[model samples]
Target chain A: MEKEERKKKVKEEAKEKEGRLTGPRVIGRRDVLKGFATVPFLGAFAGAWARKRHIERELKNNLLEVVHLTAEPADIVPVAINSKPLRLGIIGFGLRGRHLLRATGHAEPQWIDDAKASAASNRLDTSYEDFMNQEDLNVVINGVCDVFNIHAEEAVEAGANIFRQGKGGKMGTVPKRYRTYKELIASPEIDAVIIATPDHWHAPMAIEAARAGKHVYLEKPMTWNVPETYELVKAVKENNIIFQLGHQGRQTESYIKAKEAIQKNILGKITLVEVCTNRNDPNGAWVYPIHPKAGPDNIDWAQFLGQAPFHEFSLERFFRWRCWWDYSTGLNGDLLTHEYDSINQIMSIGIPDSVVASGGIYFFKDGRTVPDVQQVVMEFTKHDLTLLYSASLASDRQRGKVIMGHDAHMEISDRLVINADPQSTAYSEKIKQGVIDPVVPIYSFTPGKKGIDGVASATEQYFASRGLLYTYRKGRRVDTTYLHMREWIHCIRAHIQPSCNIDQGFEEAISAHMATIALREGRRVYWDREKEIII
Target chain B: MTKNHHLREYSTFQALMLVLLRVSIGWHFLYEGLVKVFNPDWSSFGYLMDSKGIFADVFKYMATHKDILQAVDLLNIWGLVLIGAGMILGLFTRLSVSCGILLLSLYYLSHPPLAGLQYIFPQEGSYLIVNKTLIEIIALCLLLAFPNSHIAGIDRFFQKKNK
Candidate 1:
């Protein structure tokens, strides 16, 4: 009887312990004290450590996948290895060019090791010191000549074997480096030339580079018009020099991963994509800071005015080049191209069938010839999707990209946030009943047909549940300049075409340029894919 | 609430003026706050002086020393949002007006672009500071002079609810 009583007591105690373990336990003061008795700061420490580990794991996974994709060849089945660094030669020593050079891996050699030592010593000064010492590039040569519009003798004097056109080349003064581009291209040591010149000069310089047999890495909004882009594309194809257009975000790891996730249907069938860039500050809207030294004497006045309407050389146009229409494609070509390139890559969108736009020079009453705010809607046939792209020079909210699809919508910025909306009856039913039989396909209700905008509701719920509107920073968000330069180097070594090649660059430029035309003309422009023209 | 048996001459005129006043100021605050919220690179706390220059130093300091700055940034963002919401809704008008003035004042003081004591015409920096803060302060004064919230707002509804 006593033994039976003891066994009953033991079983009752076990039940109590299980309840405390599995169920939400209302701990008394004594129990709380007892919990913390063993390790005073254990809970706090563990929580922090767990969070760090989670973030680190995400970053590591991102790096691993990106490294794999970059190393592997699409043409071949699968060979995964990170790409080797390629050699790069920068021509200009100006601020913009210098920034690009600094970004292209020319910082400190032993910065990483120094960082560890600093961490051990708990010295922030050492950390700063390391950063200063560390270079971001393997090799960077200073003061290369702007071969564009200069005499061939001067180009040779500047030791520029790989000739590049600065803003001066926009006026059509072929640098005297060689009488024709043929001599420049035939140079043995010159492998590639990066044309970081104005819009009008882009096609001329790129064509020259292509003709020379030297690979070309040209800046954004590749050409002036659709016909120009087509011509440039032809030249690139004919020459087959490794051409990389300067939409550097395509080379970024975040963008590559985002693209992969979308291709893998991580966010389901994408239907709507929205991109916005708002700049409250003057500088953000491409109001270039006027250098005190800026004048006709300091700047190549006539050269800067090339192809532009017969406006005299002024400090304003020379310094604030982006604000002028003749010099640039305005905000659409300058800022919107980056957003568009990333959007197309992420959602696998080719050229859009039609583009509708609305814009005007509404703000910055400063003497500028381009619209400060613009919105464009491009409808793509393949995905049956429409992309909404908007930019405001007056406002500051810079929302990156939001892609909406059937199953889930993703708001992509520094990270890819896949949100599962509850209103998605398909998703909800799948969750509740679990995966249905392979033979039984689930039918989804469209927003209009359903009582509620099901997808919208699901998106709202998804955001609410997560206590966040979007997931941020899945991996380290890179400075795109470095990524672009790295790709250039990588292509140089591997003999592979960079992701944002001539064709992609030209297409991106045409897309934006057409939109600008549409907005300016106040008419819907139909892109004739057959003729490769914007009507 | 007492019903107005004696219809006064100034009441209608006063109502029109109050509505107009509230809306204009409310819009100004709303737009200002919204613009800052939208700008991606518009950081609340980043720059601190270094060899690079004032702007670079401020940004570098904020980026490098984020621990304290992050907390401050969160408050600033939410504070602006709340101010915007309050001003636009005309709910707690006086409180919103005072808060707006205080915010502008604090910002002005933090980076005072003031001249020496021979205060003649205010410089551009001073002019900018004074322009925003003065408007916010006037809005506060107006709210105080005539409790606009009580006239036609959530405050009136709340007053009734409490009663």
Candidate 2:
């Protein structure tokens, strides 16, 4: 019995040793503690994140409260309901004319196929998608007119392409082609006319269209010369027709916001505004490619020289009309007018008191009379500001529009950025307290983002400046030209004036003429505000 | 104990250092993922568009496709979050390390530190093919080779149970 008890005790001791070596089958308190050892690190991370977010939120709210500006995009006006489908006519079926037609839901079959092929190869080219998604304005192209037979044929094909499809697709009824703008304007089926002709032809076509009781959408630099600027305005006003000049910058979202900022006095005591245009290419300098098929037989050379000085039937003069002063206002009307109109829309700085301009045909010496490089300075004594305009067709050095003030300066493109001045009377207190950093932007509005940022990164600023970021409204990219045309169509139906009305067109033309005279005459030109004349 | 024979035993200091490294990387990944999740406007579009080097076209192609970009963004965010949580808890740490390495490799390849290349998004510090992302990837590789998660992490329970 004693021996048996000893063996049993030894066996029990061995079992205990094995159990100690293997560890407990069930979890112990010590094991549980070891397993959760890193939980405290997660806790620390949560605490730190929450604290950082809180601090950032507080600072953002404080700065926003001081700035007192909402970063929301302007509300898009909804199309008027129960409006009838309006009839349309297009007069110059050139490059720009086709673009306008496409915006109104018609595109040539060749363009559609090209756009599709481009989109298929390069996914980043959203042009096809954007064009397909554009809202139809419910207007039929009933009449088409062009001096060149090829352009007229293309316009007819494009006008009939209501489906916006590739080649060999179903098409709508072909529009009737007219040999002259007068014939198209007088057509009973046409309710509105779009004038996209040469600068010299803009006023004549528009005036005739206005007198024919048809609404007009005239392309800009409203007139070729100073004399007809008055005549076009009088005809549109007296005829009581809805007129829209093609200053599409009037529909730019950033310009709308800029106007609001000015009204709210965001930039205190604005003193100077600067704008620029830089393009370095053959096409940009008006060395447009002449059609191989174009000649005296296909083009109506006599009708083309409507009010301009007579010129020989040369394809260069016919296709690249902007290079000559006989048919073009050169850089003043071709490019600077766009910059001037954008600034005018934002600041409402009417015709300046005096303008001095100078430049020469430094580049593209292709026997062109127009200057490829030009600079015009206009003094606005009433507003205590000077508007500086500069252009260079030989060098594409991007310089954004800037509006300077005592307290801040704003740089505007498709996005708007305002930086507080280092030495300022308005924001001096905030800058001293470190709440507002002069180096950083005091306010920045980027469309498609949730809210404004007090500080934007260099990448954001760069993209915004280059207009690569947002032409978006509520996450959808929209073409400003489409919007501009829509506005004109709506105004024709509503019997109202569009944004770029006759009055605004008058100011745009006179200002451009003043600059041209200053450049040509080699002296300062003054606007006689009392008599509405350039002296 | 027999199964652990194949695994090298680490000293207390060594184990602590490994755990610290794993947790800090996890913290970084988690924060980045969370920031993207919280900001609705956040997109990889700009970064991919600005991609340089040999794989630039591939990155740009990914950005241009809307559906692919959305899917990529979701996968990137959740991949980071899951990998981060796994690393911190010492669960599935090897898989996390491998995935983290893959992601870092893509980022590095997309924006290689080659001469004559400039990026719009400013970098905090200059680098010559050896940025912080590369260093972090090396650290993760170290963790993969000498893993201590089973010793001091939630992985211990599973490992212990398996034994």
Candidate 3:
């Protein structure tokens, strides 16, 4: 019996050991401690992350207090589209004309089809989507005018595409095609005229439209020469018509912010401003491909010459009129005016006190009179600064617009970036205190980018520095041209002067003319502020 | 129960090293996820748009499609966060490591360090066929192969209860 009891006890002990090894065991302090060992690391991470964020927030707040600019883009007031549709007449239905028409909610069937195909093939190409989503401005093309027969017919078809559809889609009423701009401007059915003609014809078409009591949307440089500049301005003012010069840069969000920054004196004492244009393509150089069917038979060569010097009915002169001084205002009117107007919009630095310009057609030797490259320097003695305008059609090295000040320099494009100067008296104390870094932007404003990124990445900075043809308003990408046209239409209905009014156009025209004179004379030209003349 | 034999074979130093590696990776993922989650404007647009390699078109499509992009952004942010929490807490460690490997693999494929490829976002260090992302992925694989979470994690308690 004793032997049997010992064996049973041994077996029971063995069963207990097996139960300890395979079955659930009671929780011990050591087991609990080991299981929760890594929990402290998570607590440490949270603590460290919070502390780091606090320091960054403090620094960002300090920097923002010093800057005193809003992180969000300026608010855009939505225009009401309740009024009756304005009857429109478009002259010079060429490249720029087609673009302007599309901005005003009219695109040809071919363009619509092509844009759709492109979007389908490449998802990144949002052109078709953006165009289709564009708000429909209440306007109808009542009249169309172009020197070329094909362009006029195309404009008619595009005007009839009210549904914004592709080929074989629904169509609307076709606009009446006028053989001449004067005829289109005189039509009683048209309430407004959009002149997208070559340089020589801008003033004449605008003058006729203004006298006919029709609102005018004229493309830059405003006029081809000095005398016509005065004539166009006087006609528009005398007629009391809404005149909007096509400086779509006026609608850029960065320009608006830049204007505010200047008003706030964020850039201390202004010293110099530099703006540039760089293009490296045949089309950009005015070597536009000649239409095969374009010739004396289809084109109205006589009317096309309008105010331009008489030239043979050559397709080159007719198509690429910007290449010659006879029909074009050279680089000054064609390109420099864009740069000049953008500066004027930002600084309100009207006609410069004096100007000196020089350049030659160094790149393209395609029998063109206008220089393919040019540089113009305008002295703004009143503002205590010098405005430098440079152009290069041979190399597309982007040198963006910059406004320099004693304390800080601002680079403005679709975005604005302000960097404090190292030697700046205003920021030296902050720099020494390590509150500000000269290499980093003190104030960076990217239109669509939310909030302030005090230290934006290099890629962000690069993109911000690059020029964008489109601008953002309220975090939405909008065609600046569309905004400019909408502003003009709004002004016409409201009976108010548009953003780029006759006064602003006068400044733009006189400035461009002074540069052109300086280039042609190979001497410095002075602007007589009192006489309002370039001498 | 037999799996416990290999789990017990790891020396204290070896288990500590494995736990440290897992936590460090978790920290990286957690921080990355939190930063993006806090920033309202953050989007995978730039990264996907800059994608190179054979699957570039597919990634680019995801970036351009608004609904798909939103979904992708949510998935990426939450995936990193949950996977990171799982790794650090040693809860479902195997699953976390597997998910991390998959995420890193996608990143590696999108921006492979091939000889002729260049990226807009400047890289900190020069790389050839191998990069930091690839290294991290390999490390996650190592963790997958030798999981010691039950030894020094919340998994230890659950493991004991199950036994």
Q: Write the per-residue lDDT of candidate 2 for residues A1-535, one digit (tens) a residue.
A: 9999999999999777557546666667876887888878888988998998897677677667656565344455666545777889999988889889987889999999999999899876778888999887889999999999999999999999999977899999999999999989999999999989999999999989888889999888899988888988899988999999999888887787788788788789999999999999999998888999999999999999999898888899999999999999999998888999999999999899999999999978889899999999999899999999999999988788999989888899877888889988988898898888878887787766675666555666766665545322235677788888989988887788989999999988999999999999999999989988889
Worst-scoring 10-residue span by lDDT in model 3 chain A: A467-476
Give the residue spans of candidate 2 off by over 4 A. Answer: A1-24, A71-82, A457-459, A462-474, B1-8, B160-163
Per-residue C-alpha lDDT of model 1 across residues A1-535, encoded as one tens digit per residue: 9999999999999777555445553546654443233232234434654685576455435333322222211231111234422333334323354345445433222333444566555423333343233333333232233323332123333232122222222222222333333354455545666566667667776787787676777778788665677778888889887888888777544465556656766456677899987788878877767767545554556655655677876777766778878777887888779889998776658778889999878988888888898899999976789989898999877676777777666666543345454455436564454332212212111111111111123333333233222111111224566557656655656678888887678669778877888888998888898887888
Poorly placed runs, candidate 3 (over 4 Å): A1-18, A71-80, A457-476, B160-163
Kindly indicate the candidate among 2 and 3 with the higher DockQ. Answer: 3
Query: Would you list the clashing residue pairs of candidate 3?
Result: none
lDDT of 3 by residue, A1-535 (tens): 9999999999999788667667767779987888888999899989998998898787787677668774233344456678789999999889999989998899999999999999899766767888898888889999999999999999998999999999998999999999988889999999999999889999888998999999999988899888988888889989999999999988887788788888888789998999999899999998888989887889999999987777789999889999999889988888888899889988999999999999998999989999988999999998998999999999999788999998999998778889989989988888899888988888888777666657665665653444221122123467888888988988887899988899999998999889989999999999998988788
Better of 1 and 3 by lDDT: 3
Candidate 1: misplaced stretches above 4 Å?
Answer: A1-95, A104-143, A146-189, A430-478, B1-163
On DockQ, the candidate that comes out on top is 3
- Candidate 3 scores a chain A TM-score of 0.94
TM-score, cand. 3 vs. native:
0.95
Error of 1 at A144 (Å): 2.8
Assess the local accuracy of residue A157 in candidate 1 as a C-alpha lDDT between 0 and 100: 32
Give the least accurate 10-residue stretch of model 2 chain A, judged by summed lDDT: A466-475
